[model samples]
Target: MSALPTTATHEPEAPIISAVKSNASAENRVHGLKLAILLGSLTLVTFLSLLDTSIIGTAIPHITSEFHSLPDVGWYVGAYTLGAATLQPLSGKLYAYFPTKAVFMGFVFFFELGSLICGVAQSSTMLIIGRAVAGMGVSGIFNGAITVLSAAVGNEKSPLYFGIVLGTSQMGIVCGPLIGGALTEHASWRWCFYLNLPAGGLAVLILAFIHFPELAQKKTFSMALVRKVVPELDLIGFLLFVPPSVMFLLALQFGSGNTHAWNSATVVGLLVGSGVLAVIFILWERRMGDRAMLPGSLVKQRMVWVSCTYGMCNGCCMMIASNWMPTFFQAVKGEGPTLSGVHILPSILSQLSAVIVSGALISKLGYYLPWALGGGIIMAIGNGLVSTFTATTSVGQWIGYQIVVGAGRGAGLQAPLVAVQNAVKPSQVPIATAFLVFLQNFGVSIGIVLSNVAFTQTLTQAIPLYAPSVSSQAALDAGAGAGAVRDLVRGHEDELSGVLRAYSEGLRNIFYFLVGMSCIAVVLSLGMGWVDVRKKKDSTKSTGDNEAQEKKVEEKSLNEA
Candidate 1:
């Protein structure tokens, strides 16, 4: 027998996505222009936030130049990603407990504030701080976008609408480097951040006008309400989660080339502390039971953990590759930032195309497992091909290889998400999504750090071997930016080719890691039980249906218990 559950098992009694169909009549639904405006605003915000993540990759070289601080580049990216990962799951509970519109708008305000801070940052430390704040907002926005979108359109059409949101948002990510390159070259690196201020403000303004149905709450604020809300947010779990994540990322950032040696006291202490914190967090969550950030019952499910692992590996493979390609083009081929961004269009376009096509196929065939498996296999092959790139690799080869990688990533990017939605009970869907998103972002943080470690370690070793006159420490001091790489080797014409070759080899080394990660993703994906999303049925009265589903789930839970 297949591992896939043919019927509902023990799940939650109440759905996280409100059964608005039963609560609100058809006549009261937002449609036409109002609906368009709401969705458009949400989609725009999503695009801008995701765009910020990739846009900085191209701008980093310029930013490093302005501040003359090459050592902080990893922190710049990792700070935002870490912040987002930390807050992602918590945001789900916030939405569940508060007025949806208000909570979402509040996050937008903070996101914009962070963007403004980044736009005017005068130092690298200030910029890193700004990125962290902005990431906090992004985490909430991501969770809210899907939650509100589902509630706005109802369950029947959410899949299609979600596809649109994801496609549009990813378009921002694809176009980020292009826009960042243009702004950084023609204007200033600061403009890359300044652009978000106006755009984010506009999104906030539009969101302010739209009123989403509010969950019932206390009419007046009181200590009692605060007491009730604090525990629901799982503040203790939040505290426990932070130390390990912070320690782990700090160890990665500081251990290799950034500041400290791997065996240095700081690095060793952080790694050991992180391990201890992780154990404590797991034990804490187990004690918290259902109130935990990672609820024990839901997390123990085979499908949930499998999907989460796939998401983590998928994140590691795709993000590490996408963020580093511009540097590859700039360093190896000596392409200008704008042209390098343009060259990456093949990967971006293919990824976008695959996502849309795969989404439609999932909707039509109702099966995501085949696409997930195929995507993982294709991605592994793509990354493997990319790992063969050399200093003199032909343009056609690079482009073709990237296309394969992009297509593969796009095909499976959202497959795990789709599987989670289908496998979990309606009530558990939101948390499950949040958990996956957290894992994905957390994976992204680790991937970028891992890439940094590999790049710095390999480049440090290869530089001196290939170009004996140039000190490896000097190149290490140049930081992870392409511009810095060129500047460090500028006067030594005889050593330039050797240095470029070293950079190329170092990059290829990172791809080798990505290839392995992609393969691991494929293995994890195999455990996602087969379920046909297309053949799924939606009952007219979800509230009544929910009750029946609950009874079935209860029996299963009891039997297992």
Candidate 2:
């Protein structure tokens, strides 16, 4: 609300201060070098974490084949996500207590160790454990990157730096599937996990040498401060929050198809239990005051709630498209993982380009709402176009559809983060940002699970109708087996073509659902109020006041002479 006192004013006697006394003479040469190094290190971490999500998706079939447990494949991805989502809020408190650099380094180490375990894993169980471990590190890495960026640049330059970090991160998401596909096709799927080893190691090295002034140990560890803030960590809130959240996700992912039926006690119980726990967590948070894990004020902020909702919707659409589109390519287009990844390239590239462009524009214009709304609308349109795809759709048409979806995602992804960062106070930035990430993650998990359910159900119903001679039981068996359905259909080209058409139809249905979801996102984006980057306003006013005061000082000196 008010301008933060400039460092020049805070430390008037510092020798370098004189250089910054006037606008033309101002120099941040040393600070600029430090910022570049820190940003570079953080960018790598951001890229790798996002890259893992898509890269692994492209490698899922390979992992399933090696483990010979197709049913358990979801856990490999789910475990990592669950771990990351669970630890996100905690990372905020950890930053408050520990030296940020040390914590960041420690987390990267954990991430590398997890990558090593995953690369060497001989069984699904081992891989799941590895994923869980990697997720813990990932949770810290992403949150840490954002926290460090804000602290290093301060509020005035934060949006620009945040945009850069996010934009760079999108590159990892774009490249991940292609990289994973190439490795899976030519070498081994194991390389997907192994790739992170070198990348993570490089990031660790960069961070070790890069001086982040924000993370420097300012005061000796204070037991009193720790004691004061410990209650705010909301251990009980987490206890209520995590188990139910995980259970709800599990119910969504595993309770469909062969794992459990919608009517079954296992599915019904987990879903109901999760709901009750969520309600309890909210109540507990309300009772805890500042100690609440999610403060009540967070919900009251219209911008925060709207931005979060918009993020959740966009996240849902993005995940659904990313996860299922590859499968569609394999099923309908008869493409391998490598080709499927390549086909999706347009979407990934567009997303990356859009993010960078949006970041620059936001920095220059100092507004985010219009971009947010435009992004949502474009995403809706793109998703709607994708819903029209049929088994016989041309490759060019497919590529076009992908490009549209990518553009929409790219435009929208960074807006919510900008909105939240702009709306909250500096101290609340980490928690607020974490909350946005949490909702996005939760939305992604939900989207994948929901889309999978819809796809499975549609395939089940259509397979029998489209290929009557195949028999319902046989179709079910084929659907359950890894690659067996494709192999079977490959042998009976004519009949299988019909079944593939049905699968494509089912996919189109799921895309339609995504389109509707994205439309809702667009509506939510429209509700994000107006862009109001707090520091920008204060900086402009302060600059004007300073200029006017300087003129008065110069006039008085002249009159005295």
Candidate 3:
């Protein structure tokens, strides 16, 4: 990868030039009203960006119904994460070379554009494209928000600003289901995507007024700059990374379906070619060594490996069944979208509460390992119980089961980050964080696909046995929507019971997959050696060390990227 270009820092003499604002002392990054405005806008942007991750959960059934694309269910959820995971590294580099404000605004524009496309999507393919585009934008939105915030503020007050941002992110996650449900039920599902426009516009408008701090070094754009930027972005590595991954994903999408047998030539060829390409990619990265997108020296570290793997496992545990939670209510229980959202509130709220409580406790006690280990075990138990849920399961049992799963997830989701952060030196924090974050998203995408495969295969068989008279494909065509499957066997109590039973079997398989994921998480957590965050040196010494690290980071421009 090439280095970011350098020149004496100054705004270009152009209309689009950024109005450079200088940062203040660590005591107060920005004072009074200006700081308030910046933080508020950043918080809103953070909320808007993270909101998309969860908002679509409640709306998925509606989307599938409208598009009548049961086979594409995984794509709807996974496309965003796939885009985000692949583009994630490049976003940080873009910020390094490009104007911060311009890059940030460009990301917001992409996000809005995507939302508009999704709002008016005519088919499953269009919706997936919109989701992918939005995910691409989201890959940078949160990072850009932080970068802009970092420029506006100083080091000392960083925690407070980040707290606000993170808190808002939590709010976005919890609120997404209800908002999507309400919109899907009362308004139109399209309204769910449309709503992002006004909110995101407000955030963008607010941000335009805040002149960001100038970089220590920057240069004007030119042909030479583009050449330099390409190398810095690791274009070859990115190219190698995306194609094989897509092929592998395609294999998963078609391999277990009725449309394609597991041993079909297309599936086999994709699998074999993907493996060869993956091997080539690894070899090229090894040859590139430090220049690789995933630098060999860094990845070889035990903690980095553990953090990424552990995080991926935790992510799998969380996402494998989450997309189907609403489907359970809507399809199995005959609940409306709005009521289904209401029903899922227990999981969301419990997870949120657990996150807060665990964060406080972990900070106070100074040990994250116990929480990480215990969380996986609890999540495994929760997933097992969840898999046991049937069409006739009682309300309290389902709610309590969801609570257990949520609590388990909340308790451990942040633990891997701590492991990664503590394991790296200050200068390496950015790269480490980026790697973990990418793997987390990668995990979500893969887990969702796995869920889809298991559900598809299970339901394909179950449908034939239960609704023997009704065709399997036609039943699946019902799109897992409320009463859609039941509608197929209307007035036939035994058939309705059998059909619902088939759905319950498939959905249960998804949750059972999650149980295995949680167990893997447990093993990974065991591999993460204990580290106490509270055991730091004296404040003055720590500050001096941080200054030294900052100097190293300044010398290495890629660190900033």
Highest-lDDT candidate: 3
lDDT of 1 by residue, 513-556 (tens): 99888888888888998887755544425667899999999999
Which residue runs does candidate 2 get wrong by more than 4 Å?
Answer: 1-40, 64-78, 122-126, 146-166, 205-212, 215-229, 363-366, 468-485, 532-540, 543-561
**For every candidate, C-alpha RMSD to the true structure in Å:** 7.0, 7.1, 6.6
Q: Pairs clashing in candidate 1? A: 9-553, 10-553, 366-533, 366-534
Reference-based lDDT, residue 503, model 2: 73
Tell me which of candidates 1 and 3 scores higher on TM-score. 3
Better of 1 and 3 by lDDT: 3
**2 or 3: which has the higher lDDT?**
3
Order by lDDT, highest first? 3, 1, 2
Worst 10 residues of 1 by lDDT: 4-13
Pairs of colliding residues, candidate 2: none
> Which 10 consecutive positions of candidate 2 have the poorest summed lDDT?
21-30
After superposition of all CA atoms, the RMSD between model 1 and the true structure is: 7.0
Q: What's the CA error at residue 339 for candidate 1, in Å?
A: 1.1
Model number with the top TM-score: 3
- The TM-scores, one per candidate, come to 0.89, 0.83, 0.90
Which window of 10 residues has the lowest lDDT sum in candidate 3? 6-15
Residue 482 lDDT (model 1): 62
For all candidates in order, the CA lDDT equals 0.80, 0.74, 0.80
